[model samples]
Target: MLQSVPDDGLLPVDTAQFRTAMGRFASGITIVTARVDDIDHAMTASAFTSVSLTPPLVLVCVEKIARFHDAILRAGKWGVSVLGASAVDVSTHLARRGRPLLGQLDSYPHYRGRTGAALLSDALAWLECRTWATYDGGDHTIVVGEVVALDVARSSEPALLYHEGSYRTVQETTDER
Candidate 1:
């Protein structure tokens, strides 16, 4: 799914500076999940994005060797659960690579989504997606999907964010557009 661009194609006038500046954009953390070998797999990701609205497309980047990468690819679907402030513990649980096997029934309080991926109940929003395509991006594989289901939260609680390699928070929302 690589869209080839000739060398003359320019990304930005200041790629390096923009990257450093974008690090200041603290977005919500999310857990992307899929099943592999009849076993559940999940990963903590901060690189989730809204791709489009017409078809409800979304994108999530998985590192080439991420434990959940191959599974998501194979499952041909995924669930994106946006962590709410109260769900930090669930986020921490899914993030542990050496974690003991947690049965689906008792795993982070979840319910099966439209695509059958576990959607955390505490998430501010959860979207079930059908795998659309996968493409290489250096050390990562970018996957795009069309949302098939949606769940939203009533409370707009503060969401956990990864910044400077650690979890942080925002106290106030900016009114500026």
Candidate 2:
């Protein structure tokens, strides 16, 4: 049976506690990309999920102050590149604050998707989406998109994962617990 919080629960959640608790759920890493004019921008994000099937919707949470937040709003379209284990370096770079504004992706190989958003050529999977909706999410803004194009680039590779504030990779095991 499900239990509810105490009736006296009037206090706000502790920030550190809330963050640590949320971090326990492992999630695959992704690079959110957008293009404005001729420049490409990308940010590392893990707060992405599929929201619907009938309309093929997906949601990505971008912090209000994130560099990509405003740009994404203006671009109207975005791309999600699900990173493989080999792309941890790329993830780290994009996740850093104050990262280079120009030539950020100079070292990596990529191509433009149908929406004109840059897609990492070696990603495990890719999704190109058009913004469908937006909603308030406290310090973050929830952007919903309708999937316009998607594909799996490398299905056999292990996905890059994040848990407890660290990067990890999945491994297949023959022994079942």
Candidate 3:
């Protein structure tokens, strides 16, 4: 039987507990990038998912306070590079707060997509998208995009996963079916 709780003008759980609970769900990591005014901005985001296949849509959530948030809004276009397990350093560097804005992508091999957004060269997959819509999501903005271009790597690589607040890699196993 399902039980219902009455509304009491209070959150069901505190932020820390909510975060811990959500952390238990494993998610793939990606580097979301945008270029505005000829300068590039990027953020490590796991809050991404495909929305539709018929339209080839995807969404990424960016904290309202992050600089990348504003840049993505202004650029109106962005790229997502689904990271492989070997790109932890790339993810960590991009996730750092207050990191230098200039020459940030210098260490990583990447190329500008058709939309002028940066895409990591060795990512498992690349997606270039144009902003389709935006919605308010409390502390974060939910940005949806219609994919304009995409590519997949020729070879398979272990996917980078985030769970329990740490980076993880998929373990290969024999097919049982």
Candidate 4:
């Protein structure tokens, strides 16, 4: 038997429910990358967004402690590769820390972007950018980038997604039976 507990600072929410709430807002997946020394540092992120099209600005929220965070800051540039449907495995590699950055490159393909960031091939879109600002936001840092260049590849593939702490694929064309 369980006893009643105080609300304290908790939001009266379970982790699963919280994740599900956020998951309802579907988003594209991306691997943010920068060069750290001779290595290409990268991490998977689903928090990428476009801030303004006029100034060609975009934002990616990264955990403050992520290894690639400092690298992106140091490089003053980053690459955002919007994952295509087939890149789910690639996303997993970047999402987890301690995995070599080049490990994903082995199976997938990539080339340096305009700012010398790694613009992975087969992505639906890629943005090579120089940072405009860094804002402190709780556990994550909001990095706004000044897009120096963008590459788009036409594909019928669906975008990958993060939902309920799991990777999911998008489905097109709904049918009622």
Candidate 5:
């Protein structure tokens, strides 16, 4: 049964309930990075997806109040590092709020993308994108981008995933149909 809502049409569930419900959907994690004025800003995001294949489009949702949001808009470019299971520490560090502005990536092994965004050396894959559009998404902004460059690393590593409010990794099986 669905809960009744007021005339405002908003769902009756609170933010915590909504978040808890959404957490059931497992998703791969990625570190979205952008550079502005020689400083790198990054956020551990699971709200990322590929939108198109013809033009190679992808999008990442950023909280409106996050510093990376403004930095990405200003820079007009960004990088997405598809995290592997080994990069759990990298994700944890970047996911922390109120992290220092400078020297944030100093502890991690990274390299500069062609767009000057930082790409994690331990990533399973890398993507460099140019901002193509931005749309309002309640308290977040949906920033779509045209993938300019991308590569998949040559390694046999499981991908990091997020589900049920915790980090997880996938297991491979040999059940071939």
Candidate 6:
């Protein structure tokens, strides 16, 4: 015999269903970077958002299992490089684990932000931030940072977009005419 429990909303949702539902929302791509122990670490993430305007706060979610999770926690400073449409290769390289940051940095043109985090050169935009707070986010941690510095490197370039498990670029519609 088997028993069924009431729907209390405490149980986790199916991963496939959750992913399919969430993928409908398109977002910009970013590589979150940090300098720890004089070394740079980075992760490709789409789970970033603006948290506040008055304090110029932004948030990025990182899985607790990611190697940079602890690095960010320890360093307390990070940079966000908004990838240009031409930055697909950069995003793919940084998204993988166990890669040396120095080698990648050498391969690509980059610069250090005010917070000492590495920012990819020619990015659509970049932001340097310091950790302001953290919150629980299930399997991930929500890192909120106060923006200290930022710049738009190339506003004319198309911004990279990610949706439905693939990379996309923004298109200009005729309605804008």
What does candidate 4's lDDT look like per residue over 12-106, in tens digits? Answer: 66988877899888778998988767678888889999999899999999888887778888999889999987888889877877776565565
**TM-score (all chains, Cα) for each model:** 0.79, 0.92, 0.92, 0.83, 0.92, 0.90
After best superposition, candidate 5 residue 4: deviation in angstroms?
17
Question: Residue 2 of candidate 3: its Cα lDDT?
Answer: 48
lDDT tens per residue, model 3, 37-128: 89999999999999999899999999999989999999999999999999999999999999999989999999999999999999999999
Extract clashing residue pairs from model 4.
none
Return the lDDT, model 5, position 1. 31
User: Which 10-residue span in candidate 1 carries the lowest summed lDDT?
Assistant: 98-107
lDDT per residue, candidate 5, 1-177, as tens digits? 354566986756799989999999999999999998888999999999999998999999999999889999999999999999988898999999998989999999999999999999999999999999999887899999999999999989999999998899999789888
Candidate lDDT scores, in order, read 0.81, 0.93, 0.95, 0.84, 0.94, 0.90
Q: Residue 116, candidate 1: how far off, in angstroms?
A: 0.6
- CA-only RMSD, every prediction: 4.3, 4.5, 4.5, 5.5, 3.9, 3.9
Name the TM-score of candidate 2. 0.92
Q: How many angstroms is residue 132 displaced in model 3 relative to the true structure, after the best TM-score fit?
A: 0.4
TM-score, candidate 4, is 0.83
**lDDT, candidate 2, 8-91, per-residue tens:** 959779999999999999999999999997889899999999999999999999999988899899999999999999999999
**Candidate 3: lDDT of 99?**
99
Q: For candidate 2, what is the lDDT? A: 0.93
Q: Best candidate, lDDT-wise?
A: 3
Scored against the true structure, residue 162 in model 2 reaches a CA lDDT of 99
**What is candidate 6's lDDT per residue for 117-175, written digit by digit as tens?**
99998788899999999998878999999999999874788889999988999998787
Candidate 3 Cα misplacement greater than 4 A, ranges: 1-11, 175-177
Worst-scoring 10-residue span by lDDT in model 4? 99-108
Full-model lDDT, candidate 4: 0.84
Stretches of candidate 4 exceeding 4 Å from the true structure: 1-17, 101-104, 174-177
